[model samples]
Target: MPYSITVNGAVREVDVDPDTPLLWVIRDNLGLTGTKFGCGVAQCGACTVHVDGQPRRSCALPVSRLGNRQVTTIEGADGPEAKAVQAAWAARDVPQCGYCQSGQVMSAIALLREVKKPDDKAIDLAMNGNICRCATYVRIRAAIHDAAKALEA
Candidate 1:
């Protein structure tokens, strides 16, 4: 099947199986490698992306379901929330292995957009499945708080 989906503010037409995961479409077809492939299963938040402004596991999300909705990858993430999240991640030194940070950032941005000033519990809840092998939980929490504060300013 050929599906036309908007990605990174651009329209992408891809021909693949109906059940093809959006992760492969984004990485292999679109050449957006920022969204890494982690546990293949959705248990890991490695292939996270914003589908219509909501963070979703691209590894499991089928491309066929994305009818005309905007898919924002790490490459296309923009606006204040995205900027603050990125800056806070860098300032807080969130990534150690640098594999899961994109997913972390995407999840963080989504949380910030909704909660604005997410607390520890909220941060933990929002970032639950994003497994960072480097054990950067402390820094990830700190960066979320930092991004919330930055968004406030």
Candidate 2:
């Protein structure tokens, strides 16, 4: 089946099975490999992306289910919040294996977008689903706070 989906402001037509995970289409067909596939199930946030500005797990999202909604991957996150998050992650040295950083950053950007100055509780709730095997939770929390500060600056 050929499904037309808009990704990162570009409309693309990809031919694949309807049930094919959007992650594969984005990575294999569109050649956008920034979104990692950690678990294939929605359990891990490695394939997190924005579907109409809301973060979603692409690994389990079927391409056919994506109608006219816009998909934004890490490559599309260039807003002030994303920039701050990126800088904060770098400043805090958050990533350990670096495999899950893309999803972590995406989730962090979404969290900051919703809560300007998120408290630890808010951050915990928003980031609860994203699992970093390196257990960089401390640094992740610190980076989120730093990103909030950066946004305030």
Candidate 3:
């Protein structure tokens, strides 16, 4: 089946099975590989993307289910909050192996979008789904706080 979906401000028509995960279509068909596939299951937030400005697990989201909603991958998250988070991540040296940073950053960006000054508990709740094998939780929390401060400034 051919499904038309708008991604990163571009409309693309991809031919694939209707049940195919949007992650594969974005990475394989559209060549947007920034959104990594870690666990394939939605348990790992490696395939997190913004569907209509909300973070969603692209790995489990079917391409056919996506109607006219816009999809924003890590490549397209360059807004003010995202930039602040990116800068904070760099300053805090958050990523160790850098494999899970994209998903981590995406989740963090979503959290910050909802909660500007999230405490440790809120951060933990919001970021629980994103599993980082490197176990950089301390640095990740610090970076989130730093990003919040940067946004306040």
By lDDT, who's the top model here?
2
lDDT of each model, Cα atoms only?
0.93, 0.94, 0.92
Clashes of 2: 0
* Model 3 poorest 10 in a row by lDDT: 95-104
lDDT of 1: 0.93
What TM-score would you give candidate 3 relative to the actual structure? 0.97
TM-score of 1: 0.98
lDDT of 2: 0.94
Sort by lDDT, top down from the best: 2, 1, 3
| Better model by TM-score: candidate 2 vs candidate 3 | 2
Candidate 1 per-residue lDDT over residues 1-153, each given as its tens digit: 889999989998999999999999999998999998999889889899999999999999899988889999999989999999999999998889899999999999899989988989999999999999998999999999998999887
Model 2 bad stretches (over 4 Å): none
Q: Write the per-residue lDDT of candidate 2 for residues 54-101, one digit (tens) a residue.
A: 889999999999999999999888889999999999999999899889
**lDDT, candidate 3, 75-144, per-residue tens:** 9897878999999999999888888888889889999999999999999998888989999999999999
Q: Which pairs of residues collide in model 3?
A: none
Model 1 vs truth, CA RMSD: 0.7
